[model samples]
Target: MSLLEHLEELRRRLIHSVIYLVVGFFVAYGFHEKIYQLMQAPITFALKKHNLPTQLVIHNPVDGFNMYLKISFMVGCIVAAPLILYQVWLFISPGLYKNEKRYVMPFMVATITLFLSGAFFGYRWVFPGSLDFLFAYSHEFRPLIEVNEYTDLFLTVILGLGISFELPILVLFLSLFGIVSPKFLWKNIKFAILIVFIIAAIITPTPDPLTMCVFAAPLLFLYLLSIGVSFMVHPARRKRLKEAA
Candidate 1:
């Protein structure tokens, strides 16, 4: 296909993505209350589990409305992500060779699975742990966190963790495309570690070491795992890998 044809295809997919997002925004906005309750559930459960105070307040006049709007937008994006990814895959698939199509199904599945895993990890483990730690210490202080501040912090953590968990897939793709390889990464392990610490410092809002480690540890492990995947993807395997390693 010509460059003009590819651009046209991209334009169609972009339009489809926008339509999905618009539809999703309305559906999600209608259920914003339920979503807010769901979002607060983990924090509520944590406080109850540890017998800590559980009230979060919003002092500003418009904070509540703004929070609801933000939540709706976020929820809409999450709901529409699959449709966007599908459009993206469709747009790119036409250009791939027949042999490459064999891997497309597995790649799509792995990508979505890894993303959901990250979201679950952030919600189920990291969110509660940090919230509990932060609030448990303030039991006697009449804890009153602003709703906007709390959700902003919580949502950022959730999104950051979810995106970070996509590290393995990103590494695998980079390796598959020969952008980087296992041997190079292995040689620069120390530098990678430093970068991990730096990313953790930047991503996690909390100053607590444990919270930061929760983000950093899996990233390091995923990097190592990506090396194995990179080796697997090279067309000339076994002998080439042995020589390269």
Candidate 2:
């Protein structure tokens, strides 16, 4: 395909993705209250564990509606994630060989699964723990967290975790495209570790060592896993081994 054709195809895919997101948005909006309750569970649990007030505050008159809208939008994005991923694959599949293109199902499944797993990990473990730690000072000061602010923080942490968990998928694609190999990753393991810690430090909401370790440990494991994945998928690695055999 010509450059113009590729651009047009990308535009079409984006439009389709947008449509899917919009549909998901409306569906999520219909259950916005339930979604809000679900998201608030972590905070509620934290508050109860700390014996603090379990209610979030609203500073603005429109904060409640705005929060609902935000929650719906987030839920919509999550609902439409598979479609968006499919569109992404469609956009790039034209550049791949038939054999490579056959990975579409696996790619989508892995992407979605990793994302949800990361989100669940954040919500179930990281968020509550972080919230409890941050609110540990409630005995000295009254805690009145605004609904919007809480939502923003929650989304930032959850989304960051979700995106970070895609490291393996990203590495797999890079290996498949011959951009990096298992040997290269293994050789640069030290640098990768340094980068992973830096990213974990940035992504972790708190400066505590434990939280940082929580984020970094999985990432380091994923890096090693990616190296193994690269050994399996990298064309040069396969070719060299085949020749040796």
- Per-candidate clash tally: 0, 0
In TM-score terms, candidate 2 sits at: 0.92
Worst 10 residues of 2 by lDDT: 134-143
lDDT of 2 by residue, 1-245 (tens): 99999999989999999999999999999999999998899989888888888999998899999999998998999999999999999998887667678889998999998888888889999888888888884457878889999899899989988988998999988987899989999999999999999988887888798999998888898889889989888988666766896
True-structure lDDT of candidate 2? 0.89
Model 2 stretches with alpha carbons more than 4 Å out: 238-245
lDDT digits (tens) for residues 1-245 of candidate 1: 89998899889999999999998898899999999998888878877877766776888889888999999998898889878878877886775545666776787777778777877888888888877777676666655668898898878888877787778777866765678777878899899889888888887766798888988998888778877887776444534755786
Task: Give the local distance difference test score of model 1.
Answer: 0.80
| True-structure RMSD, every candidate | 3.7, 2.1
Worst 10 residues of 1 by lDDT: 233-242
Global lDDT of each candidate: 0.80, 0.89
